[model samples]
Target: MGDRLLEHEELLRELAAVQDWPLPKRMKWAKRRRKEQFRHWKRWIETDEAQSKCARPRKNSNPPDLKFASEIVLLEASARNDVDEVIAFLDEGVDPNLTNIDGLTALHQCCIDNCVDLATVLLEHGANVNARDIEMWTPLHAASRCGHLVLVRLLLEHGADLVAVNSDGQMPYEIAETSAVLLELQEAMEKNGFDDGAIEDARNSGPLQMLSDVKELCDRGEPLSLADAHGVTLLHIAASNGYTQVVECLLTNEAAIDPRDRDGWTPLHGAACWGQYEVIELLAEYGADLDAVTGTDETPTMLASDQNITLLLHDLKTRQLERSARNKSRPRSRTFSSSSRGHSVKRDSVNKKSHFSKRDIAEEGKQFKADADSTTGDVDDVVIGSLDDENGGNASESEQSVFSTDSAEKKALRRSKSPPILIKTSDPIQEETEGENNGSMAQRDNVVQAALAPSTLEGQDSKAELVSKETPPLRRRHRSENTSGKCCTIL
Candidate 1:
């Protein structure tokens, strides 16, 4: 046996060095290693039960009584998920890890059926979480590949190996039926301190034996999406088989919503060709491409075949095209707001400030000034000032702050009460409002000033501003009206 093993190692090494291993030799090596590991595990369990727990401890080759283990009744009860019956059997010393003819433990059956209660009980009763079936599939592999989230978590909590590879040489993560299960497995792997590269090596057996295609579109290009022989992904299979529950589960987990097959057929195309009506609507809701063309230059609608389904696809495509067209054609009016200086105020776009057009401001200022010049003091001032009084007396309060006193108290009060105002004056800020206007002249000046306020802000020029505090979105008002600084602080 030793000489045969040595000879086998040399032959395997030679084949590996030449990169020409045949499938039979590969399977042989894998089987040999597995059997040896199984024997090692059994010996370790028998010798080291006090030291550590065995994951899949083998039974004695010649047992005093084979009655306790290898019973099919426990497995049958587990398959039924009859918690009471399983509990009764476990109390009678029926091993929780008993294997049926297929070498599946009762725990494996519980996982396959997603029997949460039974699984929890089995784990509590010292069932081996990493127990493998004949195919080398642990309970974790069964739960994960079945897309059972709760079962997967239950298995993980019980110390199920996240990176365990089954007979197909795929890890639990590789064959996760749902995106959510895949994420859970990945997170567990990460928590166990497995880096991405380490995990990949475990899955693919290190970097040099890259079975994936090396056809890079460019050195930094995105990986080209690949599929199996027929380019069929799990989603394509579920859709074509009219598996509504599976399709819904995949979509809800955000599987690739519009992956194309080798024939350039999307899952939608498969659903259409197979006359899966609910699937078509579901895919549309999830934003599948309705107009996606196949390699043969046929759309899903063209292949729908059924008249009602064809009309449904047609309507969905029309709506999708309309939405896209509207998006492309609709002007982004809210993007570039009109700036008072007529230059694009791109910076202030985020502030959402309403600005007046330079031309419009100039026109309104001229008209208001003309009106003030024609009528003496207080006429429009009385009308506009009353309208500006907002909240019934805000304008009057501002008036008192501006004209009541020129003392420091008044200055402090104004500063505390209002936002800083922008005033066009070379004089000191205190002096700008120092002297009082006599009668109607004062009222007329106030109205004219509000109307003809500077349309341009000059950095070099000296100015005093009584800007109001910014608040909510400004209500749109005609530039010809409501020129009061206090009235439109938010803008």
Candidate 2:
């Protein structure tokens, strides 16, 4: 046997690698490695240490009595507050960590049922407070979600993980159903040394609670126009989803009515595209710009899905244009009124001064000289006194007349405020005549002329006009053509 085993050592190694060997091949190898066949080769092949080193533990081979007949039954009994059945199973040596098919332990059931006494009994018998179910939901997550504040507090005291996230990326505190549950979780977190951010997280606990937290933060001096990573504001989210109350709350806090996201989509654009009728009307009432174009040149009216919204935006645009026209017309009346008032003041001053003649002016001057000599003042002082009127009231009138040059000043002021008018004409014969006379060509699409203010010169409005000679318009390439040397259409 020793000689045979020594000779077949390499064959045995090969046999071990072949998992699907024939039964005869397996039996032959098994017979050689048996204790009875290895008397002299015991130290090398048949020792207990060598056998143990090469042994593979059997898979799922537990004794039938050791496995529980019903783990879910035990959990159900524990959840229903049947303390007797729970104690009977624990005393019968049932595994405390035995979970149902969904991986939920008995303590998780107790949490969902809000059975505090059952939770205490299971915890005493070594139930895990942080044991996760199929969705990675801890027992505390179940309790928090169902607004079981007392069970949440009890689980926290038993050392549950505070920040464990479930399958939905939500913490137990984040999905807490009621404010009471959220507050209880927050207090527990605070006692465990968490700071103010924990309380803030509790305030923003659930999906619907996020909106209320936004308003509270605004009241606490946070900016209502705060934007997220995507540059989406709270109003954009609320308006897009038709949260009319949240939208009104945000607008009442003075949020920007037309804040645009990174995609150049305003809140009005979002509401319009989603057909949020009330939100669209609220945004329009707060003065959202209807004509504000997006990055793709699409206006709110163009993006709107509802015909009513489109018509409303159209009316807003028309009203805005009319208002701008009225504003432009108002400046002309203001200019004319200012000019007439200046002329009236000048005429009044001229009539009052015309009453004194040149002879009266010389006689008054001699009388003032005699009074100056009688006072015995300096010669320079007497000369300065002679320059002043006796009553001193005419000095201010003279100063006003010196500075009021209305016609030239008003013309220059108006010219500086107004932009130049752009003109275009299509008459080829007139263009040729003007080009030949002025030594320049006229642009076909746009012609910008610089004109100075009008002045009274030989019964004509005299103004110096400077002409910036036109350059040849660049030819555009087809959409598919290369723009290597030509100007590309800039977005």
Candidate 3:
């Protein structure tokens, strides 16, 4: 079996030397050749004496030398998390600091795998904690980039440098997923009297670039309020995009509610012109100026659409009107003349059957009778004096004062009974005599009447029926139509 194994190894070496052949054909030939060689070796091993001799080692042959014992064992253990095998190899004498082709030590692998226990063991075995990979990534860097908080803490506790830059110029703490971990590391460094200017430098970036950076910072529970190149803050972006959740997050963080961009437009103005009702509503709730006019003298209300936005504008206007009306209605102290305080007459007793009571009827009657009785008394006196002088004075006085009180009362009643005067001209009125002259007024009246008519009683009932027919029926079957599947019945 030993002779057969030697022959196979020799055959493989010969195949390796045949590089002049076509690549594909050579590969095919090599495969077949190896298969034949393996079959011969198997036949030799099946023989009883050959198997026994192959199992035993020759007296003159020594064991193969193990190279870089500690380093290789650590690498294997780091890969597999096998502490016992690693310790044995270290005891067999190997340099702990030996690096692979990439200059990455066992500690780097443990960090990459987030294996804190194995990493601790490597450190205890005198492994270089600060050794960097070809990419200049230390075990600490690997741990941070992978979001391994425990490994990060362990490395920092063991004096890992927080400010070491990798190929991408990111620090260990800067790459950490948890802001708490990064902050704790920074505090520890500060407490230990290490300069923190490096950490501050690592966090610096341009505004637009910071959008992505700020997002990461926010994910790490860090505080950020970065603005872009155009002087637009995160709130502006959120409002422009109509990202309600993002907007809410920014607002919750107390971001400026009315930040203006380079264009001098506030978030409310942007939301208004863009037709974002929800965003506009949110901004309004946050006390944004709905009446704020732009450089063009266009208010947010003017930029809004005619649908529900009108309702919002109407509410704003109504509130303003109410405020103005209240101011106008405020009473002022004033003085009046005696003539303004005319004669006061006592009212008669009220009668239940009368819609306006007896006092009102008496007032009406007094107004209608007026000065008619006064003239009658004068005429009576003239006639009486010519015939006889005895009853002349009394009759003349009675006739002269006949309706003196009633005349003034009648004029007052006429003014009181007049219909209420229309105070506003918002609604148009049609002059019966100008039917041909004012076509617009007639059309307006017709439109108003049509609008005032009840929709259910309008002539469009047949059209409504047609529309109902065009509409699709509800997909969900009613229980009344299929009683067999009904869960309940009213009867």
As a whole number from 0 to 100, the lDDT of residue 374 in candidate 1 is 42
**Comparing 1 and 3 by lDDT, which wins?**
1
Give the alpha carbon lDDT tens digit for every residue of 1-491 in model 2: 44444448776666667558888987876776675445655656667877886796766667766844668668767767898899888988776678876888988888888888888888889988889885668999999998998888888888997877664456887899999999988877777876768644643453256567876787799888878866888888778767678888888889999888888999999888877788877887787888778889998888988798888778767877787799888856444455756556434465566554544554554453344333222212222222232224244565445433234333434443554332211111111133342332232121212111132121223212211123222221122233222222221
lDDT of each: 0.65, 0.65, 0.60
Per-residue C-alpha lDDT of model 3 across residues 381-491, encoded as one tens digit per residue: 322332222233344456455423223223323434443222222222222234443564445445434433455224434322422334332121111332322122111
Residue 488 C-alpha lDDT in model 3: 20
In the order shown, the candidates' Cα RMSDs to the true structure are 30.5, 30.0, 32.0
lDDT of 1: 0.65
Positional deviation of 480 in candidate 2, in angstroms?
A: 99
- The C-alpha TM-scores of every prediction are 0.28, 0.28, 0.28
lDDT of 1 by residue, 1-491 (tens): 12123457776775675456677877886687667667666656577673565456877798876554437778777878889988998898878877876778888887778889989999999999999885678999889878999999988888888777664456898989999999998888888988878776665541222212222222335333336777777678667655566666666655688898777999899889878888898899889988889999999988984899999998887888888899999887755447766664357563344455444544554454344334332223333433343234445666655443233223334444654333222221111122332444566556545533454222312222322234121121233223333222211
- What are the clashing pairs of model 3? 367-410, 370-406, 370-407, 373-402, 374-402, 374-403, 377-399
